[model samples]
Target: MSLTKFIEEKEVRNLIDNYVDKPKFDLCAEIKANPQTKSYALVGTAFDYLMRFHFEYKYSIIDNCHWVAHNSLVYLLIDNFKLGIEPVKPIAFLTEMNFKDIYNDSILDVKDLQEKLKEKNDYKGRQIFKVINLILNAEKEYSNFLKSGNLTDGVIKATIDLAKIDVIYRRKHYPNDLGEYKEGNIQDLKQLYKIIPDFSKKKDSNILLNPTFDKASQLVGGADCDIIIDETLLDIKTTKSLRFTRKYFRQLIGYAILADISVNIKKPKNLGIYYSRFAKQFVFNSDIVYETDEYEILKDEFKKKANKIYG
Candidate 1:
């Protein structure tokens, strides 16, 4: 069943309107300082930031790497098409095959991108080319859907097709490369590509809420959520399986609590983890839903823990 339908009435347009006066905090700095000492505290910040990028921005920060950049660009392209919206910013492609200086100017042509990918003779180059080809070929297979497709149903078939391709090549090219710093990111694309259509078709506009909330340095610390779809709080886990472990659950619940105290918005009715690699969503409703009791408990726990490190 589509869990999203159950939480429609609980969503609010501006979740932060009531608490505009809250003070802000910059937890990113704390997360960067000697992670060895406060690893647990940092984990929440790190995961929250990563999900914000993946869910809200639809791009990964680690995509700065060339190998990962290819996937990021392709995903961005597909997302734009699926959303029935044009790219908000112009996208640039590398003019040369040199990994260091691959980009020149932003070009929106898929064929031009493919042409450039073909020119590279190196192993990494070939790897990128193959992934791009997978997307291109998938696009061709689903060209029909792209024709009359609204934001609702663009091309889910192509996603499964790409998943079936053997794109995981020998690590001859950048074996040590951390594409998006998340394992199975390339493989997980198949799942993300397939699942996004389901979200777009929902009653909500699928708009991303304030991706970051650095405005709570006063009563509480800074906090952010992954994807605020309508009234749901969704986080993406690129992990191969759905492991709602305590640490993971705490991290998500922390975001919910932070969202409530900092933004004065009612806690989300639904919380979801999109296990991208598995192409499945493990959703939690009333059972694990954030409430004032849980919120106060977590708030005290977080502040106590965060203060130990920050102080």
Candidate 2:
């Protein structure tokens, strides 16, 4: 399919309707003629999603904003945290800090604390705390402003806090000339929370949010699927624009393939990309994706790449 054809919303929706029912064939479990091929290979899907990684490590056409991944992890952590899963180890660090009196003299200063943490060699803990602190500050400021009926000071303070944290974190982590992109991501994270409501609310039995799927049965790999509602699989992306790149679409398709092989559901009925920044959503035509030769090649490449990397 041409790039322009893929972007047609109406045509895409029509093709997606085919996934609403149980698939006529087990696309995920279908073994190829070759003996080496396996059902729904995840390494292949990952290679397809991140084709640049195949060429060279630390390379991608997609914007590699450091904060984006951190924000994504935090969002995922928040989802699972609300599901009554005890936050443990690495994730526990995010919620283990207290921000009540961290600020001195109304100046949210953490420089000295940051230095202390560094001296103690608790780098990961410190980094996790900074991200969580920003989130906590945002929530507190937003809620308190709503309660007090004073809209101006509270919201502005929250926005400033977010920007300040982003600048500080990026200086250490990114250390490049992508200042505008980093700043944009901070704003995106803030808007993402407001756009998607009911963060703490649980859904129906069929709808599993942020559940880790173990593909150990297939012996390929395992990963977390963002949201699986009935027969549909959806992944969230918090970006400034609504454009869906080929790699992004392929990533979701790979997850659907994994879901087909591993998850209890027979086959995913539909696939969606939720752009959290503007609350925009794009549904791809999964039926076309499953049967295409391109997907087959992607799977083959993934298997080859996985063997190369693992060996």
Pick the TM-score winner: 2
What's model 2's overall lDDT?
A: 0.40
lDDT of 1 by residue, 1-311 (tens): 11111112122111222211122211121111112222232233233323333333332221211222233434433332221113433222333221211244344355554565567455655555555555454444344433444222223333332332312321112222222223233233323444442544444344454344434323233344456665676776554334665445544555565566555444677666655434456666623434334445545554554454345
**What is the overall TM-score of model 2 with all chains considered together?**
0.40
Q: What is the lDDT of residue 211 in candidate 2?
A: 42
Worst 10 residues of 2 by lDDT: 26-35
Task: Please give, for residues 200-298, the per-residue lDDT of candidate 2 as tens digits.
Answer: 222332555444444411323335555655566677654444566655654565566556556554457678765543455566557765666565554
In order, what is each prediction's RMSD in angstroms? 15.4, 16.4
- TM values, all candidates: 0.39, 0.40
lDDT scores for all predictions?
Answer: 0.39, 0.40
RMSD of 1: 15.4
Predicted model with the maximum lDDT: 2
